[model samples]
Target: MTTQISGPRGLPLSGNLLAFRKDPLSFLTRAASEYGDVAHIRMGPSRHAYLISNPEYIKEILVAKQAHFKKAKGLQVAKLVVGEGILTNEGKDHLRQRRLMQPAFHRDRIAGYGDIMVEEAVNHIEAWKDGELLDIHHEMMRLTLAIITRTMFGANVSSNADEIGHAIEVGLQYISKKATSVLDIPLEVPTKGNRDFQQASELLDKTIYAIIEDRRNEPEGAEHTDLLAMLLAARDEEDGTGMSDKQVRDEVMTIFVAGHETTANTLSWTWYLLSQHPEVEARFHQELDEVLEGREPTVDDIPSLPYVNQIVQESMRLYPAAWMINREVVENVEIGGYHFKPGEILMMSQFVMHRDPRFYDEPDRFKPERFDGGELLKRNPQFAYFPFGGGPRICIGNNFALMESALLLATIGQRFRISRGENEPAAIPEPVVTLRPKNGMKMTIHKR
Candidate 1:
């Protein structure tokens, strides 16, 4: 015997689709507020979902009973772009791929990429002219893309960076459209949308294959320490077999796309938050100045620069890159005191959870001091501030993103202060393909 969970009433056949599509963040927030923590939501009349607002329930789905679920259908659509990489794969295959790719993201290996991260950030910041307005979102996107290309792929892709990035953006937009829409036409259909998607995807695929092929031809035992080399050279300890070209390609593609996008969004928002809150920006600069003192930031300096890290933490709390994480139930289970069917989906929104009034003081205000001594975690616990997610399937690049963001912030913040460009409206989170600024973030840089 299970209790029925009621949610917002909707029109016949459509359910809450219109409301959700119009403004997903507001809809989710309203649902949680109106129907309590475990609110039932309807995507279609037959397609059901449960928006789990409580952290305990989030912990159950992401960590405790993780084995009884799989990545949601949205990620299934992502397969169109990334193939069966760890992000979209499930069960034994996912476990194997995660284990194989784990070493490449190990802390020591991540630390080695710090120089590239700081160098890229410094180069971009130094290139910025005073009194000139810039789209900070696009700037961070390119900088992070360039850093990932050099650090992960070990290729100097500066010449073709824009082309490669445009292709990836188009492919991602196509996949996002498929995931969000009601009617997904077949990829073979020659609709204008479909043709454009295919062309963009082909360009990205060609780029990835070329990288893999070039790496394969490298001299035996050549000094290659990039992530791609690690994946290519990795062997199953028991069977002593390496991944196939397609396998390598899938993993590289997944990392390449996810690795940069999330961090770029976070940094873009960090700058925005800093621009809006001058006092916090002052503290952030103080920390950077006191620690680095006009010198470029090194990976070793990250530990000493507490305020810089806090600004990043608070910024992510406000606008997480991956705002929503969803999972399809694999077994009948009781969660948060309600019954969920095996095929039903479970969703947790970082944007909603991070801003919950119950968790933080002055939840809407930008106050980095709350995170000063790591008191935010003590007050609320792990589930409250999971910008990168949690559990066995937590983002593998969590450490990498945090370190990269902090280094980039430290390296750039030491030199200039970016304020919102005149007459530009505050960036609204669009929540597509990642939580991107709807109109992009516009700001002006001033030398410190």
Candidate 2:
């Protein structure tokens, strides 16, 4: 006899879609808490979705038996924004792209980008005035966007930062909407959403293609250390052929979208968390002061400042940028002793699992000490703490993001502190393609 999967009941036609759309974070978290390890949810009349909260089962889906699944519907819709880039690619194509791009993200190469990250963080905040109220989320977004463009693409987009940021925002919002909508509206339908998405896509293409063309027109053998240059020159060891312009564009777009948005959100959330927790913030400051001795933090300083890393880890646990990862069954597979058919969706939420009290002491509280000496991770299952997704599809820029976040925190924390206003309400987490602080994170900036 097969075990029955139970979940929250839903409306006949729309199923749980309405509940999910209303408050995805709360809904998913509640489902996992109430329904045990695996909760069945109906997205539409025909679409079946399962919320997988058990770490072992999550490991099976994302790592062990990952071959049985493909990128879920959200990512499929993301192809409109990223093309056939690694984020949306599967099978052999995904492997080939990963192989080709692996060298650029190697530890040595990533270490070289640290100085750029610090320099950008410094330059980006040079104009901040003490006591000035600012939307720190927007500030971090601009800073990270500048860093990614310079460090990876070797392009200067500071002049068009707002335009590029707006375009990216439009693309993400469109993907988030389409991913959940019951209607499979074609882009050619000329609906308002479709038209806005098309415009955003065009702007991104123009910006990326312009960058590619500029690199191609550089003097023959002109040396460039950026990821774009590497991609232009790389050849498959087996095929001895370089990527086409479109292939390069797709990868760049993926990096441009995935790379900066996530780190910016992380930094934004870190600052917010620090502001809310004074004791943790004080300890964070003490660590930076003792380690850096009033100097700027470098990649080398990261190892010495364990507390800085802990703060970031704790922040991600509270506000993971990529809150949920979804996978669609491509082949029938049995997981956690339950059989799932092809086309069914598996949902794994970092937000939900990260806060599960079963694996955490005071899971809702922001306690950086929980990760002291990385003992908590050892005591728990691997999937219990995956801010970055697991297995082969884990974030390619995980190291880069971690280094950037810590360095930025140490660097900026030494110079300034952002505090929420006494009258200001807490920032709410908006569940879009990324978990962003809705209405932006507005706080007063103070010199340390």
Candidate 3:
């Protein structure tokens, strides 16, 4: 017999809706702390959700019984912007797309893109002058966007970066509003929000389609080496046919949005954390100085730069860009001695789990060394620290994102030390499509 699940007795009708809307992190943290590993939450009058933080239960839901659940309804919002790409697709379609895109992110292929990552970071710092205050979040957004554009299409999108970035922001805001909305409004409705969403969607679609069309029209044997080219060239072994134009567009839009946004958020939070922890920052610089020796980092240097990787790893643990993940139960399942019925939702948060004192000695402290020598992994081998998630459906760009962040961190750290600018409001992560720095991250740069 399964034990009864207990959770907060939120307001009637709305249940935990208001609390969640008001402050997601606080509510979830309290739920995990007060209710233990398995908490049953009622988000709405009719909605039933479960919050699980124990790594063992997490493994059960995400790995052992993954097929018994589908992506949560919140991701339905993503479908509006990215269509049927891997992030939002289900089951067979997802598997097929993953297979096709696998080669692009293969270790060997991503290794080739390392130079581009380093070059882009170097070029970004060249435009900076000492004592200039800038929103580092915006800078990271622009930098990662540029790197993805060049590496994905081999096209210099510096000229269109601002326009594309704005479009992404608009789309992100629309999707976030949709995900959090109590009522599901039809997109066809001509409300101001709907109109703005349509305009932004059209702009993004136009931009991506233009790239796809341009690449399609390129001469045969054109020096096509980017991800777009790889997708276009990929053929199904069973059918011997490549993805259709619409399919290609869906994927490009998917990567265009997801590929850079998460990494930018991670790097932004990383800088914020490093700024607050001078000792960690000092150690980070020491590692870069010794390993890089005033030279640009190559792909081969990634393994040698253990601290660089650890800093990013620890940053991810603290403020995971993909902070919360959800899944919808497709069948009755039992987890953590509780019975879950079909159609129920399961929500897991990296923010909550990463800070659990049970796993880390000083969970709230910025200690990158905890990740050194695989100490954290040894401490908890379950699903305790899944910033990129686990299972077969893990983020395809996990390796790519890590490499880009480490290289950028090393390259940038070598030249400048960033300090939080005066009068800049404290950075708070607003849980949107991704955990975005609320008002962007403002910081001052000092040349080393």
Give the RMSD in angstroms, all C-alphas superposed, for model 2.
Answer: 1.0
Q: What is the lDDT of residue 159 in candidate 1?
A: 82
- In angstroms, give how far residue 158 of model 1 lies from its true place: 1.8
Model 2 regions lying over 4 Å from their true place: none
RMSD of each: 1.3, 1.0, 1.4
lDDT of 2 by residue, 168-227 (tens): 999999999999999889999999989989999999999999999999998997999999
Per-candidate clash tally: 0, 0, 0
lDDT of each: 0.87, 0.94, 0.89
Cα-based lDDT at residue 182, candidate 1 = 68
Query: How many collisions between residues are there in candidate 2?
Result: 0
TM-score of each candidate?
0.97, 0.99, 0.97
Q: Is candidate 2 or candidate 3 better by lDDT?
A: 2
Q: Which rank order by lDDT, best down to worst?
A: 2, 3, 1
Leading candidate by TM-score: 2
